[model samples]
Target chain A: MKSASFHLNLLKDTERLSSSPVRLRVMLPVVALFACIGMGLWWAILFTQLLMVRAEAQDIDEDVKAKSKAHAEAISRQDRVREMRQQLEQLTYYRNGVRAIGKPLAKLAEIMPLKVQLTDLSFAPPPLDPPPKPGQKISPFAPMTNVETQRFVIAGRTTKETPVVALMESLDSAEFERLITREKRVKSFRQDATAEKGGRRLLAFEVEYTMPERRFAK
Target chain B: MDADYTTVARHFQVNAPWKSISGTEVPSAHGQTVVRPRSNGRPPTGKLPPRLTGLHSLAWKLLIDLMVKIQLTRSKTIEIGFGGKGKSASNSKVDMTGVELFSGESRGAPAVRLVHKKDGWHILAAGFVPPPNGDLPQRWEDTPHQPVWELPRNFQSPSAAIAVNSGMSSFSQASAEAILREMSQGLGDSRPKPHTAISPRLSLKPQAKAEEPQKPAPIGRKSTLPPPGTPVSENGRRFSMRPLAEEGFHLAASLPEFQALWLGRLLPEGRRPTAASIQLAESALMASPLLHPAFAETKGNMLAIFVRRDAIYFAGYRKGEPVLWRRCPGVKGYDAMRNAIGKALGVEEELINDVLEDALVDPRPALEPFLHPVLHQLDLARAYLAGKHSMDTGKALLMGLPYGASHWCHMAEESVKMKLVPGHPFDGITLAKGVDASLAHLHLVALGAAIAAAEVET
Candidate 1:
């Protein structure tokens, strides 16, 4: 009875295998192959997309750097231009000032009497204080010297007997301050009289005076 | 019922087809028989028709043609009332007979007819109602008539021709006066006659002739100057004379002074004067009474005069040489110096003190009081740069940073030195870094102030 049952089961199994032979032959390999190919294609697409993204990022970085450099250069050039314009303006101002002083000086010369003449006419920047001695470091907190006061000096000469005192008074009247005199010397000379009678003594003097520093005080 | 049936049949015969039981016979009703209407029917060949061909009709036709050219169309239809009280009634009686006409025979028949009633004509105008499709009207050679009153020519006047030819209105009295004045001025012959009241009936021909002789008077005396003492005859005329000190003296002075007078005054305020202004002033002053050849030579060194708010400022080099002098303490702690160098070369104590202060301090504050003089010095520096001047770059930078004058002098010097090589000066000036920064700051401040003022005033 056992042998018979076993043989019967074997027969049943055989029948089952024979019933779906075509499905077994065709369906299994096709499904497996399709899944493999699909996975491979998906990986290729993802890799290509990643590479494109990286390239675009690099291009953007380069563009940003280039723009920053250009901006910096433009700023520098503008700074340079502004400096030049200022320098030009200052020069123009100075030129005009010199011309102004010259005009009045020329007028004075034209109107001056023959008895008076300027032996020396000089203009200098106001006198400056002596620079700090070498080998000594200056303290940062110390006040710097103001160079505003010592910028100009004027000196000249005139005829010996031209009433120097009266001339000084006139200058004072014209709003100039007088400086302390360093020297005043008189020299005597003998002059021939027009008639046969006599010789007369003539007096000549040399006077020197310093100019006070106030007229152009700021 | 039989009578009603006959009446219905008669009404049907008048509006629809009339036929016998065989569909071939014509129905006759009210003692009338149906007859076919003639294609080329004449209006009983009687008396002559109303004449509609004349100049007036032609004008109407022309008006219609112009309307068609401009694509104008009657947007609304005009209606006339008829058959009312006092209206005449028609005498003719008509009877209806039903008959069907051949469709082919009516293809080219007149679409409308004019029926003359006892009162007036009634027109049965007919045409095909266009399809509802929204197509635009097509261009065609022939168009409908327009009313005579709509013509543009009716509004034009005979004087329009004169306006078109002269490029001005003939009827404008102002234009006539302007023309007469121009003619008088151009001819330099006739004194301008006092204006007289124009007669309404004055002839245009005679007036035109009168205008011709007055053309030379204005032309002969082109000199804008009237005789110096001639009292101005006209109420509006006022002669202005610039002061001898300002105009005449400047004219007799040096080119530098002349240039200063012209360019300094004429320049637009708040901005620095340009090189072009200087050049222009130079040329103008050359022709002025104040012009001196010696001034031309010293122009490079002459001080610049600047007018600010209310006062004129002068900036220049001070010729400071010591001579016989006296020192007196002026009102405050300020010491006054009185020096007699020459007859007119007296040095003021205040000026000496200023020089001393400038020497002791940085030149910046000392230079402040003489703004115009500083500007003049700047001009000289520029001139020097154009010639030959040494540049100390580091010193220039230091001076320019604190004081404007030093910077200007430095740049001028730099420009001249850099010019040793062709185009080098331009490149050097452009590349300089220190002075440009300060100049930009000043300019920005000025511009901001100007903008603020403008906004406030507006």
Candidate 2:
């Protein structure tokens, strides 16, 4: 009798490899071969390009060097121009500063009453603003620095307070007040205590005012 | 081992003179009567009519001629047995009147003995025997030795008969040799294996029954299909997307075939693409690049119709790069068209002959209904291209119609003119060898994709 092995159905549920190992073996070599060829061609083309670039570079060597030198010289010249511009701005700022002070000083003389006697005059710098804290909203209109200010103090004894008041009114004119207040030009103002002077039953007072400091472009 | 069997055959010979029977005699002048059997060999003893003789002769001639013709036409010779060959036991001859048996015995006095029966002839004796000394023979073999049934010495087995019928003389010899060799080999290795039972690895087990069907998943789920313009994995093909040095540009390449398509990012990479991306622009990003060059060649904004067996893919390109891709069902894909063509062409559903042929000749009729949907798709694609890709529609729209569908060029151009500039893509780009008008038009999508892919910054 024949063996029962013939009736057996082996290989059930066994999965066949979808991608053949033989195919992979063949494909890997073929792929590698093609890849090598591709790389060879790529390198060949790259070499050719490099050679061409080198030839072009050699051809334009002097011209490039000359252009580089010219570019460096132009940069230096631009730096000099920028420095001169800064200097010119500073000079303008100084001139403006002197004018600002002179106007106020000249106004003080014009505004003073004939009965008022001047004892002393002085100047003080503008007050510094505190640095901003973290997360604090800074106002755009706020002055960035205390570089723009002209503060002055005037001391004199007047026989009557009317002249002093008149002097204060004269100084409060729109032109002077605008310069001192609108620009945050006048940071502070105060009147010192009165003092008797020269046996005229006179009252002595000291007045302090600030005008905007002069600024120039940095 | 060779096996043998024996079979017996019997032969007999007989003759009878029944044809000499006297017919009815009539009284005539001088009392003379005639017997007609002597004149005619047939029992109906009379002269045959001339017409009958002529007819018989004609029949014989025709038969002879037919036999000759048959002999000439066939490779083998035609033979009609006429009782000249050696006789065998089973061989017998019959005629219209009675049957005749030829004698087989060489020892007996040659005598023809014929038996006459009402229906047929039977062997009466081997020959007429005159008893020796006029004494009746007592023993059965004594009277006249009748031919006894003799066993045949040779009778072929079934295998031998098959071999003989097959005209292979060596088959039986080879089979005998093989059997003997196997026997010798088996005898030489008489030892039995330790494990006569079936091996565990070779044993069979009952297969598991199929499980019940699972519930359907929720809708709006992402499909396994790749996003439009993204490379798809195909059997025997590999597609990989490589980023170009330029931002928002990618090269999708398939190796071994070297089919490449260029992808322009409408949405940035790494983001999950929308359903629209997969449906509208899948072929553009994922399809082969053979479709891209026409717009580049035409150097204008254009809509390209790529006709395939199952679907017509449409893509609009600006400046030689594909902006959108859309797939419209081909006539072959429709059940109605498929059934109609199947019946008309007498072909299966898989056969796309009629659909392709009709589209080639005059597609306007069959494709008329579907063109609206295609037009809608094109409108959507064009809208997307214009709205998203910033492609200008004002430039002349060049239509890349298939080579076979050139008849529809004017109609397509006119239909598309309402929405786009319809021109030929071949007007501008210089075609390399093999990218002719026909191929460029037919596979506009693939070519466009390829051209776009090559543009990658690599």
Candidate 3:
């Protein structure tokens, strides 16, 4: 038989005491207080970080809004620049179409024959294109072709057609190459409205000559 | 007509009948009277007389029930003592201290520390500590005072068991043998001794045997008490019981409700040893001899007489289980015996030990007056065991008395006709270095308290 069979203990469970010096009763509250304080400090740190991050996010949002508006304005200015460039390029084409007519006129005078008394000398431009239709838009600054033909009509009391022909042949020479082309025509010779003092009734003649073409280029 | 007996009356009305023909004579057909037993030794084999059956049983049951109810009512009203409420479950490595308090002397009481290591218990220390100077408070409202004893470093342990000798604590015991004897006074069942010799079976396989011996009755079959661990109240006292190995036998102990709380908290919890178990002094004394070799040699069939300063007690064991525990009424303890020896021989207090141990002097004049009644009671316990359990107690252990053991032994051999063997409480235990073995007798209750409190389950 075990010795417990003879033991008759009178102590109750509640009355038993701890022999150890370290008591949970005294230390429990202190440990719990420290735990609570530590948790509070940790939560405070997290709260501070959250506030700082939120402020940084707000600043970034405002900066993005300002940058977006500036970007839109820059794009509109780029479109306006492209439209002005196209108009300027058309104006440059008009400026390049000017013809040097003074040199050609001076050369025509020099190549005129002495026998041919020139009463009237003028250049008449050739009809180069048909008239525009009703609804078609035309740009005035650009010409259809840089080359042109002009008829040089010569009318005078030339007395005979030979003199006029001689004048035409002289106009076709290399000295008048920039002024006139080889092609020419004689129309009719008729007496002038009044005879010269010598009482000679001269026949009146008309001649036409082709002029060189004028070019417009860069 | 009583309200409490109404149920019993209704029970009898509904039941068919009950009859008792136990040990009655029957007339044979040949004109001769014969006593015949049933073939199966069972009840209700034949018809029985029914005239006074119900009335006889009803009257007896009512009387017993009324007595039990009155006892219970009285116990529940007022309890000023306490019972053991602390559990003794502990690790094998924890050291335990056991002490006996309020041990009749004002100065000090016995104390010891025990530990169970590799094989068995070893004593760390043994001696005495200051007593509780009658500071047993009866209620929680009472003012608390400083503890009388602070265990020395050598005796201090992780846990302590205290055995107190106070009027508030009580111990009692009863067995199935006692019940059997009461049921039939002189009808002794002297059974053959339990089979102790080895069996002669050499077969490799188990074989059925028609010649197997019978075993004793199952435990608690004839118990007259309540279930173990439950309290039983009688004569205005409440008790708690623990069952024994022997069938229908149990050891019961009790303490006042107030006293249990006080004893449990007597040792303040701190650096000093805390009380792990609180028990009565006699209850601890009952287990003092459990570690002795005599118990193991007899296979736990033994008896012991404990002589204390104030009282004498008898403890009986069967198969290491408690079979009997009784305090001798009217007879006093060792102090009374010593006083008687001193007055009879007219010797000084110091020379009293010499007269009893020295065969040169005849101290029968004083010894006979004290020993006759104590041994006569022991003989009665022995006779009761023989009639009921069929085991002969040839020798009984005597302990707790520091002197006059030889005289008590001589008187038993001469007048009582029983052998008395005095035992040392530390006989089967190993003592550590510096532990004094000579003082083993003085720490009987403390040693038993430690042994019982440090119960190692086998």
Q: How much TM-score does chain B earn in each model?
A: 0.15, 0.29, 0.65
Highest lDDT: give the candidate number.
3
Per-residue accuracy of model 1 over B1-458 as CA lDDT, tens digit each: 22432443344356444233212222222222222111111112112235756886676545543432211111111111121111121221100000101111122211111122333322222111111121111111111221111102211110000000001101111112232233223212212222111111111233644644343334222222211111111111111110011111100001112212221222122111101111111111111111112212333122222211112222111011000000111111111111221112333544543443343534333333333233333434334332322222111111101223332343334533311110110111121122233222111112111111111110
RMSD of each: 65.4, 47.5, 22.7
Who wins the TM-score comparison?
3
User: Global lDDT for candidate 2?
Assistant: 0.34
lDDT (Cα, tens digit) per residue for candidate 2, span B1-458: 11100000000001112223422222211122211111111112122346556778677545533442211101111222222211121222211000011111123211111122233322222222111122212222343532221111111000000000001000010111121222233211312211111111111122311221133222222112122123333332223232211122222222211111101111112121100111111222222222224434455355555443344555554444333444453333234444444565566665544454554444455445555565555555565556655665532333443332333344445565533343443343343233335423322322222222222210
TM-score for candidate 1 (chain B): 0.15
Which runs in model 3 stand beyond 4 Å of their true positions? A18-24, A62-218, B1-94, B132-134, B138-149, B174-239, B244-249, B270-272, B456-458
Q: Please identify which of the two predictions, 2 or 3, would achieve the higher DockQ against the true structure.
A: 3
TM-score of 3: 0.56
lDDT values for all models: 0.25, 0.34, 0.63
Better of 1 and 3 by TM-score: 3
Native contact fraction per model: 0.00, 0.00, 0.47
Residue B213 of model 2 has an lDDT of: 18
Q: Tens digit of lDDT per residue, candidate 2, span A178-211?
A: 3453322322323334443333366667777666
DockQ of candidate model 2? 0.00
Superposed by TM-score, candidate 1 places the C-alpha of residue B355 at a distance from the truth, in angstroms, of 99
